[model samples]
Target: MSCVFLALKIGKVNWQPKLNKAAHHTSDYCSTEVILRRGQPFNISLNLKTTTQSWDNFTFIASTGPSPAESQQTKAIFSLSEEGASGWSATQEPSEPRCLSFTILSPADAVIGRYKLQLQVLAGNKSSSKVLGQFVLLFNPWCPGMF
Candidate 1:
């Protein structure tokens, strides 16, 4: 139900390897490359440090598909409070990583491509979105061999 992916990437970068915030995700490798099967939810988790008082208003928007909502690769807003528990809400902490979980779904003919992650936190009446990290969706190699 709840898995962690820390292998993806945090923020943007070209082919070159630049240092940035270490993205905490459900994947163990990083936040760039992920292998999944068709028609299944690739469970993932990410930890984002925040100073907000409440995690209820925190949300994350991830774009795994090149196309918008039509490509079956699009994702909706994932609430950190709804997914996992962040000490920020329970206790008045300065800043802590809000652990959130979500699933990335690939279609039957899913093309191996890049998926980006963006985190959004809402406080009072204001909201903000930021590019947190990214990951690659690869075809599952355990698929039944064709005859």
Candidate 2:
């Protein structure tokens, strides 16, 4: 007898809504990439190869533009416990063991472009960072408060 199992890496991320809900008619032309709208919330699930400790602090980083800088408002850094009001925010959702799920939201005034996402895990004095992936954020004209 032979046994085989598929393994997922620690930093591997799986995003939902690969196809736009309302844009189903254009699915054929739409690129198979993560495309999001500003001011709207999206879901992402990350698979961890190892179990996380209670003391582990997780931080998410989202940046856009050629030069992404915090001072320039092109970068956003948020944590798992709290959500930001002026920029990007990530809220943890219930999930199974060895998996982390989050509901992420971007400010309406965020820059429209391809944004790179990274995750930083801090466990006491040891810290590690990984580039999760990138997504395209477009202007949310239909969102309330947006002109």
In model 2, the Cα lDDT at residue 33 comes to 71
Q: Compose the digit string of candidate 1's lDDT tens values, residues 32-61.
A: 444334433444444544221334555556
Candidate topping TM-score: 2
Best by lDDT: 2
TM-score of each: 0.42, 0.81
Misplaced by over 4 Å in model 2 are 1-11, 18-29, 82-86
Score residue 111 of candidate 2 by CA lDDT: 84
Q: Going through the candidates in order, what is the number of backbone clashes in each?
A: 15, 0
Q: Which stretches of candidate 1 lie over 4 Å from their true place?
A: 1-52, 65-67, 81-112, 141-147
Question: Each model's C-alpha lDDT?
Answer: 0.42, 0.74
lDDT of 2 by residue, 55-115 (tens): 3367889999988998988998988756655567888888998887888888888888999
Each prediction's RMSD to truth: 11.1, 6.3
